[model samples]
Target: MNLLKIENIQYSYGKNTPFEKEVLKNISLEVNANDFIGVIGHTGSGKSTLIKICNGLLKPDKGQIFYKGENIWKKGFDLKHLRFKVGVSFQYPEHQLFCETVKKDIAYGLVNKGVPEEEQESKIRQVLKIVGLQESYLEKSPFKLSGGEMRKVALAGTMVLEPEVLILDEPTAGLDPKTTKQVYESLKEYQAKTSSSIIVVSHSMEDISEYATRLIALDDGNILLRGTPAQVFSNTERLNDMSLDVPITTSILSMLAQKNPSVNTNIYRYNDTKAEIIRLLKDVKSIE
Candidate 1:
């Protein structure tokens, strides 16, 4: 069964007002098992609104959101349970942090669900490690940590539940390059182990292209393109027209192809780009 599905969803910011503005129009999406979906769009493209609707945090003006074939908005559908199953961490998760310590913050959800104290402690430690934090830091105030550290804590809080579908919005917004990579690696590893689906909204073409199995590009509240990273990035002209740039690796490969006919310009991943370059170097050595 599809993990989550959005069917012809429409949303507006205001109703019957002069300032009313529609943010989404007939948006449809299907998330399957073990799917890693990347959503990209400029400001006001409704990416945030769409994700919020997926977890029952926001109601759509039209259409329905389904989790495991059940309409999320249907009466007595257990919205609380749906939220627990489909975890969502917003762009600035630190805003939601209110506990005195990181451990308490991460344990809040467990407490609500009435999980055993011992299991909560174990899950807290496990998720902390996944987020690359030391156990010693658990007692420290989340408010005292750096921006990147706080973000990690927030991520751990959501991940501790081991939700079937994880949604993150700019999860790496405040992190350095190394930290960003570590966060993505942790998420990738978590998904691999649990077969859970992930939906990430990011502006970084490089990171998204490398990690996401599929890509969705939104423009003016509508889906402009959707496909594998290579397939979507292949439409350089269309993306450029939409003010979106392809991954740096893809652009570099395209440049290499222009100079060398044998170069494969379809590469969108950094590792693949490096491998292609190494193969070319070996070919040159053999020729010489």
Candidate 2:
């Protein structure tokens, strides 16, 4: 089933003023169950705007957004209810954390929804585990934690609600390599366990290539490419023309293909590319 659909939606900033500018133009996208979608583009490519529209944070200037076949902007449609079904964790989400303790921060949304206190505690524990945080840290101040831990807390806050679709913008921004890996691992586990969809906006070609089941490449508020990571990254010239880059592994494979036609340049995943190179070396040894 299509979990969310954006149909020919257009958005602009300063709509009627002298500085009016359209950020998204006739953009259409559909998210499905258990989808791990990556939205990639350079700055001002409307990646953030599109996700905001999905979360109901911003209204489109033209067109409609549908959640499970229901028009979200139609009269009597509850935007607040839509948010509970589709959660968003914007860039630098850690900065929004304000509760005195990690437990309180993660429970804020549940409290607002008037969930039972016992149920809130259970949900908090479940999400904390999902985000890779220990129960001991739950009693500590969220602000005192390491940067990565704080981000996970923010993520846990959103995950406690178990939204059908999770949207994140620059989820791993400013994190170290190990932390970045951990964050994605947690997200992958969460998606697998809940069978929920995820839409991530990231600048790291490498990260998105490694995890996303599908890729959407946006340029100048338009979708320039959309496909599996391999299919989209194969268009190296098109992405390069827009000042975007393919994954580092993809670039390496492309270079190898240029030097040796026998090299398989179709791979984009880091592990798969590594395995392919190993296989090629084994073939050379056998020939020798």
Candidate 3:
């Protein structure tokens, strides 16, 4: 079943002002329960604006947003409930951290939800582990942590609420390779444990190719492509036209296919590409 639906959504900034501009135009999409969706686009393609609308942070100038078949903007609708159900962690989430202690920062959502003080501690600890942070760091000021740790603390704050649909915008924006992998793995583990729908907005084609079950590519405020990673990545030409790159391994495979028609160019993951190369080498040796 579709957990969320956006139909014909059009959003504009500064509506009637001289600086007015439309950021999203007639966008429509469905997010199914437990689906891992990746949103990709060049900067200013409205990725952030679209998700803010999804969580009811911004009302669209036109069209409807439905959460479980009910329009979120319906008169007298309780949007606060929807906000809790669909948690959004914005870009540079650490910038949102504002508690004296990491534990308090992580428990902020729980407190807002009116969860008991005793339960808040348990939930905070659980989400802290889910975000791959040590319990020892909980008492430190969020500002005292490294960039990566601060990001995890910010993430833990959102996950502690146990939202049914978690939306993260550039969750690993500036981290090193190892830290990026850790963050992605933690997200995957949380999804697996909770069966929650996850929407990640990222520019890393490799990360999306490896983790996202579905992909959506935006251009000029419109959806240019939507499909599985394999389906979307296969259209390398179109993505390039949108000023987006495919996974590096996919690019390598494409180059290999140019020199050797026998090599499979459909590979995306490093492991899959490595296996195909080994098989091809074995075939060449057998012929020799």
Quickly count the clashes in candidate 1: 0
lDDT of 1 by residue, 165-184 (tens): 99999998868999899899
TM per model?
Answer: 0.96, 0.98, 0.98
What candidate 1 gets wrong by more than 4 Å, as runs, is none
Give the clashing residue pairs of candidate 3, or none. none
Residue-by-residue lDDT tens digits, candidate 2, 12-94: 99988999999999899899999999999999999989989998999999988899999998999998888988999999999
Q: Would you list the rank order by TM-score, best first? A: 2, 3, 1
- Give the C-alpha lDDT of model 2: 0.92
Give stretches of model 3 more than 4 Å off.
none
Error at 227, model 1, angstroms: 1.1
Error of 2 at 17 (Å): 0.7
Query: Per-residue CA lDDT of candidate 3, range 1-288, in tens?
Result: 688999999999999999999999989999988799999999999999999999999999999999998999999888988888999999999999999999989888888888999888888888889988889998999998899999999988898889889999999999999999999999999999899999999999999888999999999899999999999999999999999999999888888789889988887887898898899789889999
What total of clashing residue pairs does each candidate reach?
0, 0, 0
Looking at model 2, residue 107 earns an lDDT score of: 94
User: Where's the lowest-lDDT run of ten residues in candidate 2?
Assistant: 251-260
Model 2: residues with Cα > 4 Å off, grouped in runs? none
- Pick by TM-score: which candidate is best? 2
